[model samples]
Target: MHCSVPYPADHPFPIENLPYGVFSTAQDPEPRPGVAIGDCILDLAALTRTPLFAESPVPAPVFAEVRRAGSRESVSNLDAFVALERSSWRAFRRFLHGILSREEPLGDDVLVPRTSPETQMHMPITIGDYTDFYASYEHAFNCGSLIRGADKAMQPNWRHLPVAYHGRASSVVVSGTDFHRPSGQILASPGDSQPIFSPCKRLDYELEMGFVSGCFCLSIGAQARLTWHHMQIYGGKATQLGQRLSPQQAQEHIFGVVLLNDWSARDIQTWEYVPLGPFLSKNFCTTISPWIVSMDALEPFGVGQYAHEPALLPYLEHDGGVNYDVDLTVEIKADDDEYHVVSRSSMKHMYYTLGQMLAHHSTTGCSMRPGDLLGTGTLSAPRPDGLGSLLEKSKLGREPFGLGSRKDMTFLRDGDSVRLTGSARGKGYTIGFGHCEGTLLPALPLLD
Candidate 1:
């Protein structure tokens, strides 16, 4: 866990923390996947040239093919690549550590130029399924009070389990992608009048964390024969043949973690979410940071599970179950150029751990794949300023919070930008998910 040489003090990546992602040099023909360390991108293609990679158990042919295929496009499909066994990935990281740790001549050939500021990063995977879960206790309680009375804040099941809904994965985009204002039907009052179609009046962002699924094998004939397979198989040649049969060995299918922003329309959600759940209000758009911080990299940050009140279901139970101790924060910038820390919370606040969520997701025997995504919905804090969304912070637009220049605010307006950041603190190195950011653009004019 210790690195021999120090990366630049402020560098996002260090040898101790090699977070992987897709990147391309300014002069390169296309983007290729690489690992970040000390301000430089460790070119996987170039790193493959060394003898270190030749000795590893990773199928060299498959590795070479994935690297080549990924290099051709602006973003590499890391989902298929990282699912390889821990041993293979460990060997690769160890090889990289030895080479990138020093300024040795052997390392020079593998090093891509220190040009991150000039280069662009793309989404590391092609997300196939997206599910957003209400896991944060503070967020649920606070928002619950807004709709329901203070005494009746949280639902009975809120303290017991993780509540989630399926979201549209097609709408998920990488950071830096612009989101258009959604036009939806809104009702002024419930059961009072007909709804009107108009541009979203209250556009907001939900600060969240997301973990990608590893891989699961599903049997063709049997319903209960589904099993979890180690991720390493995903990068092998057999994957092309789809060896993921139900009777085969199944393992935890966890790819990594990424910062996520679930853009929401409060006005639309309030009217739509009742007997059914979020529809157009949340489906319009979602964004995620590019880097995928592997679960192996976050081993040091794992902590005990969130406190539970009622007896849990057997499906959600596990031995030595726990959640990650990741520190999360959200920042907001107003039109006047002032930045404010809106909320600070930890992943430990989640009522359900990723393991429980995944287990619950599959309890009904639903098939999961390499690129599926599960969002930890709105991680909020207990204090007033620690709220995650504008709806909770502004008390559902009933009370206003001061932002220096502006005397009042309900939700995001044009020119308002929000950013989400998360990191796991280690002895000397910090593993981080680079910012998931977006700016609110003006809603398009409506036709009469």
Candidate 2:
């Protein structure tokens, strides 16, 4: 994976990095799938026509369906699209790498007309359901101490399993989509005599990563049955062998990682999440950057799992192997102000890996799908500088930390914008999920 020629040194897409996505030009009638290489998009559909791709391991029908499905459309549902069983994915990557080599022909036919960066990248997949998991120990402890008193912070089972709750997927939007502030009922005080209904006051963003399942698991038995049947009938073991994934296999199931910002309304959450859990405070709008960075691209950065003392159930148990080495950081910017890095953390802080979460989630035989998203709850480090949310950084709005412009933030205020960026560094290149950002608009004017 060495290259002699450079691609301007700063382009998001270099010959060494070919992230895939669907895009379209104003002149083009519809969106088509392509790979980013240098300043151009390697039109996959066009490339499929070349003799080079004739023997590609990727099923021909998959490319045809992509062209037929049109560009800028959801590619998540297309069955064969993400089914690059490990071997196929590796082969395709090598094929593309060879073609994009500096010595390869850099002629007009090989490149497609470039599309504007401003062009929309539709939701990569139609998310069926979203589950946010509290896997980061620092984030859990920090937020727990604020609401549950310092001594009685995390729940007894917090360290044992991947704690999560189902979230509304319909409200999840692709990046660049503006979200309207949500109106909800809240208690004026913890022991208030009455509840007040109003738009949320403390809206905030959560920085997290997500993983997608590859083959749909009807049931643990179903997967087992399929593997056995394939081996018996085809006289060949299933390509994706082995039950229960290692940290590496867990990465393979990841279609791609995205910068997810789970918008929150602390005022509403505080009042509602007593006996039940977050309801109105959370379900408003969540945004994710459009591109899905394949897990294969992030393999170079896999790291050791976070330490844990709690014992696990038989179903949830593994080698305690979970986590990634991706470095994550958040930036906040007020109106017309310079952005400042507020926190720095790594996915390695997570108590449970995505594999453990999936195994635990489906232990009850619940079905899992390709586009379903599992949010690795806010990744926070142990120190204050690594804090992930405003609630923790500002001591629940009681303390004010000064930003460079004399601007102090207790929590997000109207017109404040937040951005999250992440990357997995490699030998000669970097894999990045651009940015997930959103600005808080003023609440709708009160009605007379």
lDDT of 1: 0.72
**lDDT (CA) per prediction:** 0.72, 0.68
Q: What does candidate 2 score in Cα RMSD to the true structure? A: 5.3
- Estimate, for each residue in 52-157, the C-alpha lDDT of model 2 and write its tens digit: 6665555554544444443324432223455334454456667778766746565555566444654445566556669888888889888888888878889998
List clashing residue pairs in candidate 2: 31-71, 32-71
Residue 413 in model 2: lDDT: 76
lDDT of 1 by residue, 146-173 (tens): 8887899998877666799899988898
Where's the lowest-lDDT run of ten residues in candidate 1?
Answer: 239-248
User: Against the true structure, whose lDDT is highest?
Assistant: 1
